[model samples]
Target: MATRYTADEIVERLRSEIKDRRPLFMPNCGMGLSGKLQEKGGSDLICVSPTSWWRLRGQGSLAAFLPFSDINELVFEMAREITATVDEVPLISLSGPHNPLLGHREHLKRLWEAGISGINPFISKIYDESFCEQISNIDMGWENEVEIVKVANEMNMFSFAYAFNPEEAEILTEAGADVIASHCGATRGGLKGAKTGLSLEEAAELSQEIFDAAKKVNEDVILFAHGGPIEGPKEVEYIFQHTNAHGFTGGSAAERIPIEESIYNVTKEYKNVPME
Candidate 1:
């Protein structure tokens, strides 16, 4: 099983990496093998979420945002499977706090008991302004995500909050999120990724804006970049070069694209062998 870490411990570990100028890498994993391999590859953190479950099953990452399965339950199931393979790396769950059937505190406690060390808000960052306003009207809004982060901190669990804009970044940082990741939209590149979104330069500028907003609330808050045009090593290097982002968070870029390419190539190579 993966080793569970306290919020402070996780922060200190990442801070040490930053002190040495090493970029942090947080990858989303749906399968045990993926998490195990990522741990070996020196992943700073592993995220188990409903979106990754959909991606591993050959569905688009957005499928998780639909009203299909219970999102939090799906994360727990994936976390259990992933923890069985990971050893020392910390596991963070991308979860929704608006489950009518489950309270957020209980959900967080269960995550901790299942060997997850952290939490990140999912589904909250994917909505449009209209939808966000509608959800906020019903009290099932971004405020719940902020409350989750606040509660996670009180419980000594790490919180990695995703913010789409500077305002959201400031709110999350004020809520005591240990890490604030500027989400640029759905990642682009894989078979199921977004084909069109912000350019790399635009994404970097947006990331810097979000980071600056977060730093205003807490200058020591760790900053990360995610999604949109930032796909692989080259694009992430561009983000690092252009912004003050401390690291990156990847979903499709980490698992789905690599799986698609590697499996397809290896299968093609085997099929190309001459027959008797």
Candidate 2:
């Protein structure tokens, strides 16, 4: 059976865990990746989305290329898959403002009823509509993004903001984001032109800024870092030591990049092995 947690209860649990210094290692995942991560002791949070789900299931090329309307069913299907495949770890839906379904409160309520524990309404600031043709039509303004977060909070879903800078971070917190993630652009091996946003050094410097801004509004909000310079446990530890963020969150880094390398290496080596 699926476990239900209110936004406040989820935040309280996350806060207590962070207070104990048990840093969160949330990785974006779907069915296949969730199963692998779960077998390896699991993540503190698992981010579920159409993109990652499709990618992990061998339809990755279609993930970024598909539109929100086209992929919404896949997203919901993946959510049900996670409910069956993963246990304990909070499943946060990584949605966007362009999402046709999540733009309304009733749909958000339906999502919660379907067993999703949280929502991460990620708004891409740098890309224009033309630029995002490969991704979805994520043309939501800051106010639109904030309103989504507000509705998610109103629904009592654990709301997370995927902010790339301190300013966005501040706005999201004020708009009622329970968790604010400094989501730098994707790193090497992710989508084309993925290496954008703050450098690791710059992100470390901005962490305090994000933390201060968030704390000013919601003192109990959780801060996390994603993508860019952060990869693996060492980088995660470095971010924790250098920044005010409590944990690290990964998507391609935790799912695609490593999987690509491992699968490629293993398959290549098998070619060298005797097939006869």
Candidate 3:
């Protein structure tokens, strides 16, 4: 892909999106959905992680299934793949607690030089419960995330901080995260009996708290909400009305859930066709 905008340019565009009050929907996608999302007028903010990227490329789950010992290698490979696939859209790399950036500054610089627009150091307890437990010996806390944001700021790169509540949002914003995302856990895709986080109303309320905390420090910081029950247009509209969030960072809500429902309905309808 041809290089278009610099990292600072991407950050400026994100700020512009907030100033305009137009909530940009950043759908986490790979080659399959990025083009379609662009055609439909989604935000230039595109997110991709090793787990999701591998799944998108038809490689199944991340390290759970694949034999990968080094996460840094995985991140580089994922960035390369996304770099080759995406054109103009700004790519955001979602790094977990295991990534080298948490410890090594040079690793963070490498991520920026690899054509990545931004970095989201996300360690979702609910989404990665098993992985977290597996790495219980290793310390992966909020301080590391703050350090990642600080490093990104030092490099003039955008940092999308994943925060579960208002307190986390405040700390991340104070740490110079360009975007403070209020996130719950990943929503269960097409599952009838599965656990989820707060309801949409609760998510909006939490977002308002996060907004207040973030505004206490930097009013220009881009705020967004994700996961939990905030999916679809009505939910998104509710969050914007109730909270100060400028948009949402959609993951499974943008990809798996819709595809599951659509494919099932389409296949069921075809299966029930009458024969002559």
Which prediction has the highest lDDT against the true structure?
1
Q: What is the C-alpha local distance difference test score of candidate 2? A: 0.69
Root-mean-square deviation of every model: 1.0, 3.8, 3.8
lDDT of 3 by residue, 75-103 (tens): 66666666676677777777654444446
Candidate 1's displacement at residue 192, Å, is 0.9
Where model 2 places Cα greater than 4 Å from the true spot, the runs are: 32-36, 57-71, 99-103, 129-140, 190-193, 274-276
Q: Indicate the residue-level lDDT of 234 in model 1.
A: 99
lDDT of 2 by residue, 211-240 (tens): 777787778788888776776677777788
Better of 2 and 3 by TM-score: 2
Clashing pairs in 1: none
- Ten consecutive residues with minimal summed lDDT in candidate 3? 57-66
Kindly give the number of clashing pairs for every candidate. 0, 1, 0
Model 1 TM-score (2 dp): 0.98
- Residue pairs clashing, model 2: 55-60
TM-score per model over all chains: 0.98, 0.84, 0.81
The CA lDDT at 76 in model 1 is 80
Q: Cα lDDT of all candidates, in order?
A: 0.91, 0.69, 0.68
Q: lDDT tens digits, residues 90-181, model 1?
A: 99999999765677789899999999998987756586789889988898888899999999989999999998889999999999999999
Better of 1 and 2 by lDDT: 1
